[model samples]
Target: MTNGIRVSVVAPVYNAGPFLHAFVNSFLIQTLPGDSIELIAVNDGSTDDSAAILDDFAREHQNVHVIHQENSGWPGKPRNVGLAAARGDYVFFADPDDEFGGPEALERLADFADEHASDVVVPKMVPRGDRLYAQWRYETTQIDADLVTCFTTLTPQKLFRREFLLDQDIRFPEEKVRLEDGQFLSLAYLKASRVSILNGYDFYVIIHHPQQDHLSAKPVDPANYIGSVAVMAENVEKYCTDPDTGDRIINEIYFRKVLANFTNSRVATHSLERRQAWQRQQKWFIDRFITTSRFEKMDEIAQVRTDLARDGDLDAIVAYARAGSVDFTFVSARSKRGNIELAGKLSGGFSDGELPKLVVIDRNDKSRIVTIPIQLAKSQVTVQIPKETLPLMEGARRYDLWLSPGRGHQNRRIEGPDRPFSLHFTDDRDVELYSTKKGNLSIAVSRGMSTQARTKRKLKRIIGR
Candidate 1:
């Protein structure tokens, strides 16, 4: 009750004793002042010392509440137990195996929710072992009053209004063993007065365990997921009174849940029973709408384009890239310097004034672009190097063009940055780029050069003897 709104966090546990201390301690350590955060944990009959850890935390901190429940194979039951005891004005749910990326994640969400008058605020979820989420303006947060109306398919990354949950009786379908997260969220948003989407700036570190479906060792359970999705579709069609909204949600359940998952992991070797289950379930969903030329044309074109641009081809990729629109704005720190103008077809080159961000990071420094997407077809683009970009080379090695999103990360490289400092007329269509720290250039992709031949060529070019 620090700011007069109670934030009740509910975490469920099975055999998560190994992570229990870290999870609870992190939540308790950075707690805000009074009227702020309180935690409620349900130790769902964990086979290990999970209950002991929860009890210890509760004993130590008055704000911690622990509930013990019998071993229930039902995945949704533990969540239900935790949700029942949450007394805060707003509630957040976490699995015992997963914990917060930063102590400040909740505080930031609270502040954003208050400022925007939002009922649900989602934080960006980043997985473990990768770079954390980047900060962005909260004005980027999007919202929809009806759950079915959200254009984005991003799943539960939110803090929910407790009252909103209770009033709508938003509880999990314990009967359905799988896809409970999808099922619960779909219903909650159905009754939500206002749902807000916060951009991905917060991180949640999820530790994969064998027992969890995400890291399951058992055979696939498409049947259970089909049940979960069917429930969602039925709820939307029956309860969501808006026709267009219903159709959109229906489409999302098909595309985002079923098809998208299929693309990611559903394989050909699943048991025939499970495959048949998925197809039978899909038929019920397909009956919701008739095929139309509008959607069909777009789908057909997307399929054709994807087929033509299969992942294996690179030159066809380069040709496709050499066709994107580009903008080349230039600035220089030095005036009246060697005039840097468009050399030829690449007219978008920068004028002599200052260096671009790309050049500054690409110099003989310890830097490269990371996590950039690669696509085909680059339009005309040009860049001019500013003297400022070339920091004094001390033991500098090589220059690199790293295509992070590509198969082989090092797309191009230039060894030793003394000459040919220019990386112009680049084929950018096949890549997305955001620079990281710069260091000695290390261009691994050779433009077909051998050590002896290169030395002779350099001798000829340098001496002109």
Candidate 2:
């Protein structure tokens, strides 16, 4: 047994032989001393060589612990086993397919946890070939500000204080279910006293290979997906006493899950049979958990989808899913005097007679959707250059521009090499641009960007060119 371990990294392995070596080797090569960190790997009945590979590591490494169990068809049971065996000040749960972004990831997490005495520390979850998680915008955030805001991300791939987890009796659902990560995370966030974030470095590299047979890669199983949501909703009602918080969580957060995860996918890609069945299941869920008041509180698009789903209108749902399509063209980016101006063209179709508008959103501000006027056209829509749209570019992050059909409708973000764009502000106090060695886009800031925007005069005064 290992002693004085700073962190216990619990990874659940299931037929992940191809990536197991790389995944386990990441912990062995950590900048955090091998003796100071323990890797508790539970092999959940893999028919592949994953068991043999883990056994070899257990023999070779002093801090490696391996447990083999009959396949449970999910990572939940295996992770729970690993959690029981973990012996560290803090615990980290990881998937067998994903690896640490860097050698020092554990060291960094340990340092941050120790310094802040935090219950949870979320490092940047850098997905394969994509931007980092937008939710992680600051170095640290206290959950007291908005208990649901900081920890809404349901992924269990985070550093948790061992004592805090035990004290709260927080564990993943044993039933092999979809979106289980979010269910456990929501509960953890609501109960957590303190939550901090550590960015500026990649802590986790999530690999998405087509050949991978993970749950997400498989076909949509409506029963399991809705089951997962039901479990999470039950916990929310049980734990949360604040009526207002409960209402907001159910409407704002969980309602989005019902659409984005359950309804949207079923409508967009699944077969007609599957779509109808999924709708039937979701309708039951909606009637019970999702109140009429909550449905009314949803955004415009969400309300439309929910109504269509309730009515079982498959054709209308499909049309609504494909209603708005935008092709945005980035013209140029220039800071004028104290204003950061970005010019782009909006070309696409809008439904509900909704006009095209330039929308700028910050990574931190989830509620603020700023709309800028655009010039509409027959074949393709156009928007004037960075004129009075300066306010759109003001954010903690270099704002991501979206050509939205209407104020509350869905937005299509313009990405890729063609008609590219970037933002640079003279004032490095709140947000600035910097190039990373890995070539990922991130705005450099001395401090966290203000969640609330400054008045027009205050913004101009601070952003002198």
Candidate 3:
């Protein structure tokens, strides 16, 4: 029982002295009543002033409790200790370096969980500044799909009912496991009876700094990287029994996340020798878990990236990583003579000589290639989403933006910096631009104009001129 407490926030403190003030202050100032909230601060043998900070907070605030232990080198042990000591109805895991997004965040999350009797509550997490994550498309308060679909974000910040977690015995792996949050949360989703979400509001703020253990500037150890994936693979079978669902979670969810984060992006930054070692170690894990059919089911980019790593092709991985970070900005879109004309500029060291082509990747991951005209100026290109694509875009409500450099089958899918352009029928008369769920930058366009009407308007303006 929670003994009338509403929420318990667990934060693991190591060498986070620099960020402790902002982090602790945010929790203390929450809109939720101080007495109704319990703050479990675990001081994992921090070498800095973190222990003092936690002690001071515990002394001042009746709701705050400090637990000190020897350094475990990772967040898992501290989290498990905090969970065991938690007394609130719902438990929330917060990183010591990250701050609460707003005062109302805790209030909102607690209310939602209590009202719905939710076993799990997911609140929107916003990255500080221009940083981004692989965001989800949770349109409504409740996700229509399976909980496994929301596994893209494995951070353990969401609110989970204390009784539910205890009953299910969902605890983080102790001490030494990397990707422990992923392993713990995956099982949490599978076991949760009901899950609720708080959307369109920022509940948590993630601070990305170079010194953080998870986001260290140095290259990841190839053996440790492989070990993490192996643990996740083992847990997938341990938790999920349905053949299809387990396969999808392993192939579609876990594999994709690993490939995107480690293989495609982080590993590309490693030294050539390290990269080779990483690829070799990864193949062993991939061989045990990934089947040919499952690999084929992946999207083209994922398939290409995985195959390149498996085959020991470092050149393609390097090209893909560099090309993928190319910056493309949408300048303007107009319905020109029944064609959706789009113009954009490419920067971030991408040269027009690369022969970049704009591609509209639909929900099925099938792309409709649009021809790019010769640069009007250096690194600027104009292309059209032909009339045929309008129907596909209209149906899917979204389309990803990708640039393929050069021509032919050899062209690799290089993504842009911005979120994909979205289309929604604002009303019967017009199509509107809806940014992705993460609230990307607003794109301006003529409101209340359908494609047909916009085309007509463009033609009339041309004729009048």
Please write out the lDDT profile of model 3 over residues 1-465, one tens digit for every residue: 468788999998888988888998999999988989989999989998999988888898999899999988888889999999999988999999999999999999888877777888888888875456544644557733355566667789899999899999989988565567887887787778776666877889988866666533444565775676667667777767676777777775545545644423564557888777767776776777888766766666666667766787877666666665555566655565655566677764355566566655553445544444424465566776555554523332344445655421224343232444434342322333335554432222233455687778899999999
User: Candidates' TM-scores?
Assistant: 0.61, 0.73, 0.73
Tens-place lDDT per residue, model 1, 149-249, is 35243344468877778888888766635667777877766666667767655545555544444423454365566567777877777777776677667
TM-score between candidate 1 and the true structure: 0.61
* Candidate 2 wrong stretches, greater than 4 Å: 1-3, 130-132, 135-145, 261-268, 292-297, 326-401, 415-465
* Tens-digit lDDT track of model 2 for 249-362: 776555556666333434566788887877787787788787866666667766766776789887766656554554566554455664544445554444426566767565
Ranking by lDDT: 3, 2, 1
Alpha carbon lDDT at 96, candidate 3:
90
Q: Whose lDDT is higher: candidate 1's or candidate 3's?
A: 3
Q: Which pairs, if any, clash in model 3?
A: none
Better of 1 and 2 by lDDT: 2
Screening candidate 2 with a backbone cut-off below 3 angstroms (N, C-alpha, C), the clashing residue pairs are 154-182
